[model samples]
Target chain A: MIPNIFRLTLPILFGYVPLGTAFGVLFATQLDYAWWLAPLMGVVIYAGAGQILAVSLLAAHAGLLEVFVAMLVLNARHVFYGLSLLRQFRGAGLKKLYLIFGLTDETYSLLTTRPRGGSPQEEHRTDVAITFANQIYWVLGCAIGALLGRSVEFDSTGIEFALVALFIVLAIEQFKALGSQKPLWMGAAAAGLALALLPPAQQLIGAIVMVTAALLLQYNLQRNTTLTREANHD
Target chain B: MTEPMYLAAFIAVTALATFLTRVTPFVFLSRHSEHPLLQHLGQFLPAAVMTLLVIIFLHRSAHWSAPTFGLDAIGPALVVVVLHLWKRHALLSIAAGTVCYMLVQQF
Candidate 1:
């Protein structure tokens, strides 16, 4: 289990380190914020989307309420993640706090696939391990970024695309595994439609609504398919 | 752009709002069994979340106003996507994307 945890987490650590470092460097150089602030925000916020939004909001002179609303819309999916893991995380003890706090997207992807006994204790251990691994990677990345930002003179422009690519890869992997074109089509339609409907600031909200609607549509379709299969079997 | 005090206030309030959004669901929901509806929503949440994220990236530059339909971004994004699909590697995709972005930014 120890080895498995390390193996599972190594990829994420490597990816996050440079990404976090770039962010730290960017914040330090561009925003002139303190170095520690980068890592602190990384750990606490942990949402790349939110961090980027924060920077843009800060740049645009957006109000506090606007920033808050934007973040809520961007991160609203986390509520569903927390809900799904409730049963799996029921008895986590002190780790319960960490499990909840550290339920980032990467951690969720890792934990959902981790092999464990059906027992609550085993599930809790897996959750804690996953959470610990994810946070450690993020912090290490931030530290590297802070140090590099101060010392290194190399151009770090365009480094942000690493994260964008990472998410795209993950999404593609999920799509392949699920073998469902419906969800993909739905997402594409919803996003395109939302882009048309919402202004720049409210795009996030429109996207959320569209995605939710797509999910509902997919759910209904899946239900109908299952019923037909059962009827055929009967 | 503003005074130090305002910056400090901004960070503090932002921190509070961010923390609550992340921490609240875990604290309140972790103790309960997964509800049927929650489970239903959970299965699709990742896809939904990923879709939102992708849209944000594609639209990050505001619109496809560029002459080539964001070819600067789309070209590199396509490269990154292909590399990742083939290699199933995150680091490689990132490296490819960064190199491509830098190369494109110059021309």
Candidate 2:
């Protein structure tokens, strides 16, 4: 039955392995570190964009604080991923730690949207299976690409665009599930504002902050309106 | 680059910072799972966050100053969206979009 998880994770396997390979190739070619470090970071860091970003940062000889802050901002969206899964992950047990650790953008999207199993135990098992499967694909891909890095001579210029494609697909799925475009519009406005105002490194965090504030304000107004409507009915 | 020995420390710090971001909400909000605010955020946050991520990624990947003026990215992005809306297949959309992007970028 373990292989059953592969069926569920096939798309992610396709996504992570190639993306991880891209990271591995970049790491091998860009940094002074050994090729092995590419897969090592894949195992420990487990974030595609963050790992890719680290390649440039390390190449530039960035300090620990700089790497830390950059990674935190780049991954700030993960905070909300955990928030969305709090109830679903309640009985995940020891795997819960791994779950949180492995909550990349793709994993979180899959977890939120994948159909639940028959029971909580079954669901937790599926969750762990999916999470573990994705990481293995990523690490394996990283190892392959690192080994091939020096020998390969092809251009990898636009391969990272796979990530953009992945996110676009996920965005569409989220829209279908949520059945509203307000969030999309809000996101576009906030991201546009951030792009115009912030530097490249700061844009993600700026967009997150603006979107979060707008969401909170919208949520409060919605609650108040609902309360008022209930009172009028009474 | 700096000494190779410092690389380990850098990796350690990066992993910790990323973990903290993913874990912070669960650490602070697990006990408040049933709170109305948490519930509301849970209901809508995924959609909003996903949208934000998509926009940010598209913006980051584009080159607004280039002669192509971001078409390399925007064209493939549109293909991803349109193809997914039509086919509703994730892998197909991503593969097609990536190929489209590579073509535009290289040629």
Best model number under DockQ: 2
Per-candidate TM equals 0.71, 0.87
- Output the TM-score of candidate 1: 0.71
Q: Poorest 10 consecutive residues of model 2 chain A by lDDT? A: A150-159
lDDT of 2 by residue, A1-234 (tens): 587788667767766877888888888888766789999999999998899999999889887888888898888877878878999999788989999999988788778776665798888888888999999999998987888886767765677787778778777887897898888788788888988899987777787778888888998999999999999999
Q: Give TM-scores of the second chain, every candidate.
A: 0.74, 0.82
Off by over 4 Å in 2: A1-11, A56-70, A154-157, B1-5, B65-67
Q: Chain A TM-score per candidate?
A: 0.71, 0.85
lDDT for model 2 comes to 0.84
Write model 1 residue lDDT over B42-98, tens digit each, in one string. Answer: 655565566556667656732367576677777777887888778877557767876
